[model samples]
Target: MNIENKIDELISLINYHNEKYYNQDAPEISDAEYDNLMKELIKLEEENPNLKRVDSPSNRVGGKALDKFDQIVHKIPMLSLSNAYSGQDLKDFDKRVRDMAGSDVEYVVEFKIDGLSVGITYNDGEFEKGATRGNGVVGEDISQNLMTVKSIPLRIKEDNEIVVRGEVYISKENFQKINEQQENLGLALYANPRNLAAGSLRQLDPKLTAKRPLDIFVFNLEYGQNLKFESHSESLEFLSDLGFSVSPSYKVFKSIDDVIEHIEYWTENRGNLDFEIDGMVIKVNNLKQRETMGYTAKSPRWAIAYKFPAEKKKTKILDIIVEVGRTGTITPTAVLEPVRLAGTSVSRATLHNEDYIREKDIRINDTVLVQKAGDIIPQVIEVVKEERNGEEIGFNMPNNCPVCFEPTVRLEGEAAVKCINMSCPAQIRRGIIHFVSRDAMNIDGLGESIITLLLNEKIIEDVSDLYSIKKEDVINLERMGDKSANNLIKSIKKSKENDLWRLINGLGIKFVGVKGAKILAKNFKDIDEIMNASEEELVNLEEFGGTMANSVVEFFKEDKNINVIEKLKKASVNTKTIEDKNSNVPKIFEGMKIVLTGTLPTLKRNDAKEMIEARGAKATSSVSKSTTFVLAGEEAGSKLTKANELGIKVVDEATFIELSSLSSKEEVESKLLL
Candidate 1:
């Protein structure tokens, strides 16, 4: 074969094998064979630069950097597939497809791999670009990480322009292997494969991407040049021929029963597969037929994922215990006999509340069905009544604070048992921890470890004493140095000037959050006004529930808390609301929802929320159209995720600070009467 022909053959061979290696998880060829083919293509492209094409299998590693990256608008809006929870929902989807395309319509079904979705660009047979499926319009460029997937070809076999969409999944086996390695190396274990894939693919550098074991399966041929395929089935075949790992084993059905049968066939066998398959994606096979059907605001009209029922396993409840939260509410936890389910060893599950325990008749020594709730937290899904013994002991939520041994009480119509004592050691410590957290007052060098050190040393007993830390004592502490100590002192000093809402949140009062603090700050302007207000006064505030109103009133009524408030005043923590400020800064986001991301330049993120909310805006962690602004900074993660998804407006720190006009927003309210 000619050198050019060899390059073409290499691309075809790699994609063909990649489809097996990634999608099918079955490789007829050895890794050595795959490596040699890649080497041949790389050498050919290097020897003849003009012969190099963007879509060449060799280009999968990445492409040329741009002066400014332009967002590629998807030709067809990438829509999220609707989920079918039951067989009936699956039948409904089949019915809808039938109504649109008649009994003659063919459908394609693929494993809904629990992973990240991305779009890959191939120009003239070389992989040129890849990006996350961000809002289906603009995605973060992830060409580097996508290339690291051994299954994704650097180049394609066909000499044509193409943009194929696919899922990037970290196999459960690979995920466990990486986690075990991370644990051995003393790195934090990623929660699961999807989060790992997401974090890995979003990395800016390819060198880092090479570290993670990722795999890809091409499903949609987003764009095709010189490719003639009328139906999705035909397109998949052509793409497979060109060396892409298309989905396997989709059965064409004239009736819903066949589609239902296909889904039922996989549900039991899905577990037998090496990779995770949460659901089966059913879609119209014909491309033109899809266009005729159209779309909804979020999902496609033609496709739906029939999710497999959550896996449940019977496990014995060894005991029940209550864990005190930062707010001093004791939450019930079930200590279970260790059982392997849904990827990890399950030893404990949450009972949610006392009512949940009673409602389920859950008892110590009783075997129950435990499952990953929402595929995240482990919980007892149902009681295995057949196995229940009469000798089993019923479990009860604690009547006292687990940590402080103080009597607890649940309010009317509420399920949580709250530790009413403000100075309950658990309550105070947890509150102080929250106060110094990154989002709150954000005292640098004041993490849980440092707080433990401070508490053990008896250097600081309360949140007010946190402000009174001596630089010499802090520097002299073990595990801290002069430079770090100095920087920490500087950060702590900077934090003192933050708005009052940070103080309120850090206090860890029940029913008061960043948004709640803002409502109090804006309405009352000072803590004194809030303290003087009764439950009736609080209930009058917008969005303040009766329980929240009572909680606020009760929190302020305590003499010890009142004394702490006075101490906070003595330390000059910001207690004055900006509603009283004469600054001309217009609240661009009055009553609008806002999310904070990354580390801010000037204000702690929670402190920034305090600023935004002081102007009558509300702060939320998730972004939506209701979101007015996203304060973005270095390493912004989830809020950034939603901002990109919802197309929310984003701003830098200087702009946010400029918008707040709070150069002096930090000045303390006033020295309270002491």
Candidate 2:
């Protein structure tokens, strides 16, 4: 074969492997083998620049950084599917389709992945952009983040522009791992994998998105410039051939009975899959038939989704227990009589707190309704009062910390009863763990086990002691070799130079997160300055409220805290805030009150608010007549309705983005300033 022909063949082979690995989650070749192919492709492209293709698989790693996503107007609207709650609903949908398109009807059935729906656009087989299905007609651009999803292809061999729709999801395994990390870091647990997946997809940083184990399964060909396919199933096959990840278990059935059978099979066996699937999607297979049946403004009449209800089971609460968290907050848990739920044998479930138990009148020895929340966490849905016996005992929260025996107090506005001891063993261990975490000081070689060892061995009492550890001290510990010890010492030394916000966040002051810490650090110059500040001064910062300000003041007032700071200061740890060079940028949206609703095209809800705040605008939560503007996106829902009723000016996402970039607010102030 000629050099040009060889390059083409290599491209085809590489694309196939890319689809097999990224999309299908099955690799036919080893990593080394794939690397060798990529190596050859790069070498050939380098030697013969004329033969190189812009959309080649060689460019899959990454591309240019996107400051913000640009909006994309989908050529064909990505309509949602109407839902079918029961088997009868499915039959009715089939009848409607058959009545409109004749009895020669066929249906394509596939799993409806519980994830965010994204529209991926390809220009002449080159991967172009990926967007969320914002409002069917317009979607937020997330091309860079989508490119980070290994399951998504950067380029395809098919030389035609096409738009395909897929669900971007995280596997249950990955979700569990992420939650575990969050739990270890003293962070709030994610509600479910679906929410996590959506949040990960909308992340402003593609680098962060890449760390999430996101996958995609293409299910529809929304639009194809020059492509022709007779049926939906045919189009799926074509998409697969073109190096796209198509549905793993798609089947075409001529009879409604077959479609119903398929849905039933999946409903019973859904737990077997690695990813979460909320329901089964049944679509009319014939393209011409679909066109004839048409749409219903928001949803397609040609298709309907069957949603599976949450799985529930009954179990007895054997005992109630309280566990002290890192921050000393006590959480109540029910030790349940082992019951099988959603494929896993759950032995225990969280009762939340004393208030939850009291509200439900839950007692030990009472039978309760148990469910897998989001098919992940085991939680008590409610108490089964009818099954409760007189022998069941009422429960109450302890007056003292379970671990430290310290007097516990509940904050005025919060439900949690907290232990106030600064030197509580559990708190110290948790604090050290958080301090060395990725988002904090980021001591690479330090983990919970190592920190625990250090604590138990009396090598460290507080976070500052981490900076004082010698290599010899760690080398003698379990699993620590010479190289590991040296690395740990190096990482510890490196952490002293972290930004002041990290140190503030690592301190775990109540209500002071990364954002709040950054605000405090930026407002004040150093740790000593923050410690010396009054509640009034702390509350003056935008991110700080009265409660938060009080918490900071309280945290700093402790002798132990001051001692830790002194130790850190003596260790030469960085305590000074690094000033943002752009801090002096003109406040373009000054005095403007903006309310954002729904999901914006390219920006996450928080990202949009941050941008608005950066531009000297106040992003409020509610929409009223006083709202300078309501930035609306797809599924604007009640907020949009309220904005319209209140005579608040509403702008689409594109207009909002454009307005945000305006250098001056003079025109806006004249038109809509409050």
Candidate 3:
């Protein structure tokens, strides 16, 4: 066959199969076959650049960075929920419903996704826009990124304008893979799937987002044609019929008992699924009843989320080990008989305090009951005293640090032990890992194995050594090649440009997180200034606690740390620049954390985030107490409840725009004044 014909055949074949596999979930060709064909096409395209179409099969791999995030105003106000944390909470909600609406209320119970909320708009059966739930009223548009999700339909069935709400999440497998990549790259791994999803979705590069296996489940119809479903369950079915991946674990409950039972069932049995569920969402199933119920200033009167008790399981403690953390915390890890829990096998649990160990009587070779502390981290709930043999030994934190072999000590009212060793191998390893983490420097291809290889090979020791690596040196290593080396070196070089917060984070200083790092970096321009800062100086910083201040003080006091910083400077790693911090006028969210959910009536999603950032505040992608406000538009899901529970201020779209606008107007005035 002629080369021209071969190229056309390859492109046509790949396109056909991509649609079949990604869109249809029916692969006419195996992944290997698909990969081989794609490889051939890529090679061909590389050889003949003119033949490469802008919308070529290879372009589907993803594209360059987004110029800006568009702002979207949700059509509906995604309202918050009054949560029922316990059985009584659920019962109380039921009682309130019965008292108000009087006993005949129907509710639809759904698994509350521990994920990011997104809004997708379909106009005339074509995908129009997708946005993050930015301060509920406004969101950042991520339509291009959202389109890459295989489960999300590029086109919906209905021709009229249709808006759908969904929870965009990374599956457990994808989360793990992403984490592993982060670990390999020498970047900090996200604590959980929710974070991974948020981080992945917000990535400036759509190609990176596309590579992540993100899935969205359409659960609500915010607007548009023929979505006249009377109940939440019915709406879900209608959405499913429209080629949307609707979460199927919903149950229609007449009485509150059924709601309670459904929550119990999932709490005990969510391990079977590929995703994670933090709690159950119960919404009034009747459309008329829901419309009648309406919404409060913050939450919807028609809907309530019944959170599951955090997952916990009983297992035998096989051993107890005191490991030294990078920051010199001597933490106690309970090596337990492996038990399946919370969608993964748990073999260890963290015993936060010696007092905790004493109170719970955590011991080596003892039976113990552990609980997932917050549907995320595992902790020992209590000792299984009845099953424990007399031979079971109680654990005491060590005298010497596990890594540097220095003396370890615990302070009054403090649960953890500290090792003052800055050069401790464990700390070094963890610090290097953290330095390369996504939230930190985000150095890809720097995982533990390669770090170990570098360490073993004596190619480099500290993070600064990363800069010293030659491509030939990297390619010479086993499994490392010309491409891998080039990519890794490029990634490492790219990391130097990540903002001050990332550098602070990458430093692996105790008690200095992304938020704290930013504050410190802002206060003290460079590493030397931070190191010179006294404990009281650090303590005086806004929101800094004495314990945290002391930790920071101690971290800097170490000799090895000073050396590392010097080496870092020598390596030319940029650390002092506060990225995008040049707003002449400040917005309410300038440096304020914000969470967006539901549908916005106006504005594109990215535009909303950019607006928030244009003023002085940092636009965070998730909801937490640190978050100053939640801009809720229409159909805000779980995050609405999370904001309420965390006591973060919740605002409607109007309020959001008004606050954001105030900042802009102020900025205009400030610019004039300047």
**Winning candidate number (lDDT):** 2
lDDT of 2 at 34: 91
In Å, residue 136's CA in model 1 sits off its true spot by: 1.7
Against the true structure, what is each candidate's TM-score?
A: 0.76, 0.64, 0.67
Off by over 4 Å in 1: 1-70, 185-187, 248-251, 296-298, 339-345, 389-391, 409-413, 444-453, 468-490, 524-529, 532-550, 570-572, 578-674
**Prediction 1 global C-alpha lDDT:** 0.75
lDDT, model 3: 0.76
Clashes of each: 19, 2, 65
TM-score of 3: 0.67
User: Best to worst by lDDT, what's the order?
Assistant: 2, 3, 1
After TM-score superposition, the amount by which residue 466's alpha carbon in candidate 1 deviates from its true location, in angstroms, is 2.6
Query: Cα lDDT of all candidates, in order?
Result: 0.75, 0.83, 0.76
Error of 1 at 22 (Å): 12
Residue 560, model 1: lDDT of 79
Of the two candidates 1 and 2, the one with more favorable TM-score, higher being better, is 1
Per-residue alpha-carbon lDDT of candidate 2 for residues 576-622, written as tens digits (9 for 90 to 100): 98776446756878888999888766666867887788788788989
- Score candidate 2 by TM-score against the native: 0.64
